[model samples]
Target: MLDGLIISIDAMGGDDAPDVVIKGLEYFLKTTGKQRKARFLLHGDQAAINTLLAKAPLTKARSEIRHSDSSIEMDAKPSQALRRGKGSSMWNAIQSVKSGEAEIVVSAGNTGALMAMSMMILKRKQGVQRPALAASWPNEGGTSVVLDVGANVDADAGQLTEFAVLGEAFYRALYKTDRPRVSLLNVGTEDQKGNAVIKAAHERLSESQLGLNYIGYVEGSDISLGGAEVIVTDGFTGNIALKTAEGTAKLVGRYMKDALQGSWWSKFTAFLNMRALLALKKRIDPSGFNGAVFLGLNGVVIKSHGGTDAKGYANAVNIAIGLAESDFLQTIDVTLEALHDEDDNIGFIK
Candidate 1:
C-alpha cells in the first residue's frame, strides 16, 4: 500500500537484542496476516540472527538481514558513537534510510545514540531548525502529544514555536483533528507567569495565523488530565513532565493494587469490578503507547525504551507500520511547509 515500505530495524539495539526483536517481528507478521504489506531489513550480527531464527519458526524470506559487526552500547557517548561506530547496528540502520533502502527506521535503542545518528544521517527537514521527539501518552480524555521530550534540552521561543507547529501537524495527520489545540507547558496558566522564552512563544502563537488553536498556557496537572491535545515546550521542561507523568502513573497503579488487596472486602469489590478495573488498566497502560516518534526528521524514526521486551518490541514494530501506512512523514512535511510559508508572510507584514 505504501509502495513497499522498508523498515530498517536495529536488531541488536534494545535490551533483548536479536532474540526478542526477531520474535516481535515474527509475531507481527503472524498477527497482521496480509492486512499490511512491508519489508524489514534487520541489521545485526548475521550469525546471531541466523541462530535466533533457527530456534524460531521465522524464515528469511519475508525480511532481509544486514550484517553489522559492532553495536553502540547504551552507555557510549552519542557523539562518539556517531563518529566512530560507523558500522554499528544503529548507524547502519540510519544509513539504510538515507540510502533509499528503507522508508522508515525503528529501534529500541539508546535515546541519545538514536537522536545523534538521526540528526547526523537523516538530518532535519528543510526549514526545521532542530528535530523534536514527539511521544503520545494516554491522558484522562484519550491521548495527547508532547514534543521536544529530550532532543534539545535548551530551546528558545522560536524553537518552542516550531515544536508547536510540528506537533500540530502531527496531531492533524495522525489523530485527524480538525483544529488541534496546542498549549505551552508552564508552571502557571497565566500568560505572564513563565520566563521570557515562554512569554515570547505565547505572543508569537497568538499573533500568527498558523491554523492551530493555540491555547495560551497549561500547567503540569493538565497533561494527564488532557487539557490540550498537543503540548509544546523546551526539552528540559518536556522531559521532566514526561518522566514525572510516567513515574506518577506507575506509583498510582501500584498503590491502588496494594490498597485493593489489603482487605477481604476490597478483594471482593475488586472481583466484582474486575471488568471495569481491566478497562481502566488498558486505558492507562504505558505499553499501549510505548513508541516515541522523532518528528521533523527526513524519514520516520521511532525510538522505543531500552528495557522493552518481546511484547514491547512488537508494539513498536506495529506502531512503525501504522506510521508508514498513514504516510506520516509526507503529511508532516506538507503541513510544516505551509506553516513556514505563513511565518514568512507574517515576517514580511511586520
Candidate 2:
C-alpha cells in the first residue's frame, strides 16, 4: 500500500463535469480505492463540487477541494486556452503535480488544451526531445501499449526509439509484463517494406543494448490480433489507427445488436448464447482502458475520455493510482539514461 498517495483531478473538465467526476470517485472508493487507500484533490468551482459531493459519501470523505472559478472549454484551442487558462481548474490540477503535492493528475478535458498545459507546467523529462502520448489497445491476448497516438504528427528515427523506451516502461508498470514485445507499426512486416524513417527506427532498436523485446514490425490488422505487446508509430499514423479501430468496434457492435434482434429465430439463437455474448461484450468495452498517459513528462498526467461515463472515469482513476504507486518514472529515467549512454558509446548523434 502507498502512504499518502494523492491524485489531483480537474473536476469540471469533462462533459459531465462535477457530477460524473464525483460519482466516479465514489465508485472507485467502493471498488479499488478500498485496497489502494488513495486520496484526491479536486480542482473546480467549490460550490458546484460541494453539491455533488453531498451524494458521494466516500469521495467526500477522501477529497479536498481547491476552488477555481474557471475551466477550459472542451472545444477551446490549445493556443487560446494556454493564453487564458491561468487559475482554471485544469491549470490548478496540473499545478498540484508540479508543486509535488500530488503524485499524479487526471483530466477529462480537451486533449490539446490539457496537453498544452501539461507541457507548460510539467515539461518533458530530461533527454526527452518530444514527449509521446500513449494509449492501451485491447488485443486477443490482453492490452498492448501504443504510443505517439496524437502528440507529434511525425517523428524521426530517434523520437520513435524514445517512444519505444517510454512505452516499454509504461507497459511494464501497468500490466506487470516483463520485457513486453515492442514492434513498429508499418504497412507490412518485411524488412524492406516501410519508408526510410520506420526502417531506421527498426534498425536502431534491433542493434541497441537497451534490453527491450524488439520484435521488428506489425501490420495494422495485428493491433487487435495480438501481434505485439507494445506498438510504436509516429503520431500521424497512430492517431488514424486508434480512431479507425474505435469506429470499427462501434460498427461491429451495432451490427451484432441488429442481428441479435432481427427475427424470432435470430433472437432465439442469441438467447441460447447469451452468456458467451455477454462475455464478448465485456472483452471489447473501450471504457475498460480509458486512461491515456502522456509519457516522457516530468510528472504523470492521465488523459481520460472527454465524454466518458462514471464507470470509465473510475477506470481512469485506477490507472492514475497504479502509476502513482509504481516506479514508472524511475524506470523511464534509468532506461533513458542507459539509452543515452549506449548512444554515446556508439558515437550515435541525436
Candidate 3:
C-alpha cells in the first residue's frame, strides 16, 4: 500500500458543516474499504464529533480528532482570521498539514480563509512567487487544469508564466502528460491581440525554456473543447470564465429538459434518450471535479465548494488523499527546479 495518507478535514467548514462532513467521511471509508490506509484528522469540537461518531460509528479506528471550538465565518476577512482565529478548525487543519501530521488538507470552508491559512502556515514552495489555486474542469476530450482560479486576482505576465510552469508540472505529475500544452486565456486567438500584459506574457511564454508546448493564446470557448491541457490566467479572469462555464452548463441542461418535456412526443423522445442524457450528466458532474488544489504551497491543501454536499465534500477529501499518495507536490517541485535550472543555464549561455 502507499504510505499513510492523512487528510485533515475542517468538520465545521462548509454550509452543511459537521453533519455533511461526518457523513462524507463515513461514506468514503465505507465505499473505498481502504479506511485503514487513508485516515482523517477531523478538526472541530471533540464532544460534537464524538456524539456524531457514536450515532454513526466508523469502521476504521484510524480516524483522529483535533478539538477546535471556533469556526471562521465565510465572510470574515481571511487575513483577520489568519491572525485572530488561530484556534479555529480551518487554521488547525492547515496547521496539521504544515506540521507533517497530515500529508494533505481538505476543507469545504471559506475559500479566502483556507488560502490565507495555507499561505501563512504551510508557506510557498521555493522559487514560487505566489501560490495559486488550480482546478480541473471536465472538457470534451478530458479534464483541463486552470490555474489561479481564485488565488491572485491581480497578476503580472511573469506571474502568469509561472502559473503556466506550475500547471504544466502538475499535469505532468498527476495526468502523466508527456509535454502538457499550456495556453494563456485571452479575448482573441491572435498573438498580437490583447492588452500589454497578455502580449508580454505571450512573448515570455513563447520564448521561455520551460519545455512546455506553449500553444499561443486561447479564448474562453476553448476551455470546454480542451484547446489546451493547461490554461493560465489571473484569478479574476479565471474565476469569471469558470463561473460562466458552470452557469452555461446549468442553463443548457435546464433548457434541454424543459424543451423535451413540453409535449408528449418530446417526452417520449426524452425517455428514449435518457441513457445518452445520463452519460452527458456523468461527464459534466461537478462532484467528479470538486476539489481545487492549492499548488505551490509547501503542503497539499484542497479547497472544496463552500456549498458542497456530503458526496462533494467526500470527493474533495478523496482528491486530497490521491494527490498526497501520488506525491504530486514533491514531483511538481522537482519538475519546476529542473525548468528553472534550464532557464538559468540558457541565460548563462547567452
Candidate 4:
C-alpha cells in the first residue's frame, strides 16, 4: 500500500510552489489506481499548504503536513541554497528521508540545490565515486536509462565505470530486465573513437567481470537505437545529449504542428491520422517523462524539472515512488558487493 511507501514532499519548491505540489499529489492519487496504498509528508509553509490542502482533499486525506518557516528561492545558486537551506521545506523533506520517516523524497526545486543537499544530508554510498542523475529516455526498444545527465560535470575513467554500475542497478531495479545491455556514449561506435578518459573507461568496462552486458561503444545516434539499455558518460556530455534530444523533440513537434495546421488539406489529413498521432504523442510526451533519479546516493531522492506543472510533478513523484517501492538502493549495494567478488574471481581465473 502507499502508506507503506511514504513520500516526503517539498511543498515550497518549484515555480508553482505548494499549489502544484499538493494538486499534483491529488491528481495522481485520485486518477491513479494505487491511491489507497500511498501516503505523503508535506513540508512547507503551514498556512499556504493548508490553504491548498483544503482544495485537494484527497491528497490531504493521505498526507500529513510539516511546516517550515523558510524556503530556498528558485534563483538561488546551489551554494547559496545550501547556506540558506536550514529549516527550509527542501531541507525538511530530505530530513524526513534521513530520519527514516519517509522512504523517498521528491522535489521540483533547484536541481543543483537538490543534488547538493542530497549529497550533504543523505551522503554518498560507499565506493560510489560520484552520484549520477539518470533519466528514462524513450527509444525504439522502449525506455532506456541514460545517466550522468547532470550530477557531475566531469568524470575520469574510474568515475565513469562507477556510473556504469549505478546505471546497471537502475535498469535492473526499475525495468527488471535480466542482463540489460550497457554502453559508453562516444563519438563513434568504433573502439578507438573518443577521448583518453572514455577510451580508458571502455577498456575497463569491456574487461569488467561485474556481470554487466557491456556492448563496447555506442555513438550519440545509437542512444535511441535501442542497442543499449543503459548509456554511461560524464555529466558534461550526458547533459548536452539530454538537452539536445529535448530541443530536437520540441523542434520536430513544432514543425509538425505548423505543417498540419497550414492548409485545409493538411488539417483534413491530420484529422484522419489523429488517433495514431495522439497515441504517439502520449508515448513521447515530455510531462510523462519529467522525473530523473539521483543514482549512487544513500537515500532515494528524485529531482523534478523546476518549471513543471502538476501533471509533470506527479510524474516526478511517480519516479520517487517507484524507486522507494523497489529494491533499487539495495540492488546497487548488492551489485557492488558482487562486482568486487567477481573481480577477485576473474583475477584468480586469470
What is candidate 1's lDDT per residue for 10-125, written digit by digit as tens? 99888878777888777767675346577789899999998887755643556788999999887888878878879999999989989988878988888998999998889899
Tell me the whole-model lDDT of each prediction, alpha carbons only.
Answer: 0.83, 0.92, 0.82, 0.85
Model 3: what TM-score?
0.91
Clashing pairs in 2: none
* After superposition, candidate 4 runs with Cα above 4 Å error: 1-3, 33-36, 340-350
lDDT, residue 136, model 3? 86
Q: By lDDT, who's the top model here?
A: 2
**Candidate 3 residue-wise lDDT, 130-173, digit = tens:** 98889889888988999889898878876787788888877776
Show model 2 residue runs off by greater than 4 Å: 1-3, 268-273
The clash numbers for all candidates, in the given order, read: 0, 0, 0, 4
Where model 1 places Cα greater than 4 Å from the true spot, the runs are 1-3, 30-34, 55-61, 263-274, 348-350
Report the error of model 3 at residue 292, Å: 0.4
Q: Residues 1-350, candidate 2: write the lDDT tens digits.
A: 12389999999989999788888899889987788779899999999999999999989888899999899999999999999999999999999999999999999999999999999999999999989989988998888788889988999998999999999999999999998999999999989999989888888889998899999999999889899999999998999999899999989999999999999999999999999999999888888889899999999999999998888899999999998889999989999999888878877655
lDDT of 2 at 330: 92
Candidate with more favorable, higher lDDT: 2 or 4: 2
How many clashing residue pairs are found in candidate 3? 0
lDDT over C-alpha atoms for residue 269 of model 4: 98
Error of 3 at 289 (Å): 0.7
Return the clash pairs for model 4, or none: 1-37, 2-37, 2-38, 3-37
**Top candidate by TM-score:** 2
